[model samples]
Target: MRIQSTKQLPSLNELKEILSQRFSGQYSVKTFGAGRKSILVGKSTLIGAEISIHKNEVSIASSPPSVFGGILMTLGMTELALFIFPFFFKHKSGYRTLEREIGLFLQHQYC
Candidate 1:
């Protein structure tokens, strides 16, 4: 969906309603910079905005790679170690049980 505004565009609440109907999810929208140059969709980290502020017309595009890269960095080394430790170290309790529990939790959260 695209919105073209001759005047600065509607408020955030108005934009959120339009996006909610279009995207079908709970979303948080915010405009950033001095001219409100960028519109950020917090839930999915997707960004939509006009390429030129003078144009007052917006476009939607895929999020930047830095967002995903930051997430990977924030996971830190400990979480990575926990995930790999089970694979390299033999467990007396059995690896299948731990693996199953992790898989179930991920499925429940994502699906």
Candidate 2:
């Protein structure tokens, strides 16, 4: 996701501070470059997001873990056969929910 804000954004550290305070325990933030950082939100560490803030634009890149990946990591063969369908649906929907939440938060703060 990419957002263009009419107002200038705060410095990276300041932005991290703001997000940390707003999100509290829901997310973890770490700066890795001059204007780039990564965040892991929600209960699972399987999904990660990279955020880049430049002047008035913020870009977010996230690669959600696949349903197959989740199953392989968290379930056994018996449970997989019994629960694959619901797991697939739930995993996908959870990602969208998280994305929307983050987008709305950023929009409210910077857009």
Candidate 3:
């Protein structure tokens, strides 16, 4: 997805269309400074998300309370981070580097 900078936020219909195309589901988009936040477009979805670019780091959070709250929270946050990393971070290698790093880390387990 190509992201363009805009001083004014897009209308909900516009936002919804953009997000639905990007996420391939019912979704809505919001912007905060250099960040883009999104939410699932159904009632009581509870899939909250936020993304921000600060210094050289991209930060993202998606906290949705579920029956297994902690696990869902962690998964949401990780998904948000992965989705936004390429956009916010300026590294030449892009998110593929981050994905590989994470994969290697996951490959080694203490347990």
Candidate 4:
């Protein structure tokens, strides 16, 4: 997910503070060019995350397991699913909840 700001983006220090407070456990940050890369650790396990800060936006991606189960409950899909009930499935990926929290924080902080 990406958070965009034109003239009121949070400063680097503020961003770091927000991230440090949002996630659990110890985390380290490394800066390269215009962005920062962070690694979070909990109980000696690495929680990999990539946070790229640009002039107008911040992009976030994490490396934690995710489970997503979605269904189309529209009238047409519901009727079709009656005959294909077994088509429902679940997928896995990295975590994204932090994105929402961070996005909200940034929005409240700058805009």
What's the TM-score of every candidate structure? Answer: 0.31, 0.64, 0.27, 0.45
Residue-level lDDT of model 4, residues 57-96, one tens digit each, is 7776653211112223232256686765553322112234
Per-residue lDDT, model 4, residue 29, is 44
Across 12-108, the per-residue lDDT of candidate 3 in tens digits comes to 3454455456545433444432223433222123443343333333333443323353454355468685764554344324334433332232233
- Evaluated at residue 68, the lDDT of candidate 3 is 51
lDDT of 2 by residue, 36-89 (tens): 454434435445455667668887766433444445546534656576656555
lDDT (Cα) of model 1: 0.40
TM-score of model 2 vs. true structure: 0.64
lDDT of 4 at 54: 71
50-69 per-residue lDDT for model 1 (tens digits): 11222454444333223563
Candidate with the greatest lDDT versus the true structure: 2
Query: Which of 1 and 4 is ahead in lDDT?
Result: 4
Clashing pairs in 2: none
lDDT of 2: 0.63
Q: Kindly give the stretch of ten consecutive residues in candidate 1 with the minimal lDDT sum.
A: 45-54
* Candidate 4 Cα deviation (angstroms), residue 85: 24
Backbone-clash count (model 1): 0
lDDT score for residue 37 of model 3: 40
- Point out the higher-scoring one by TM-score: 2 or 4: 2
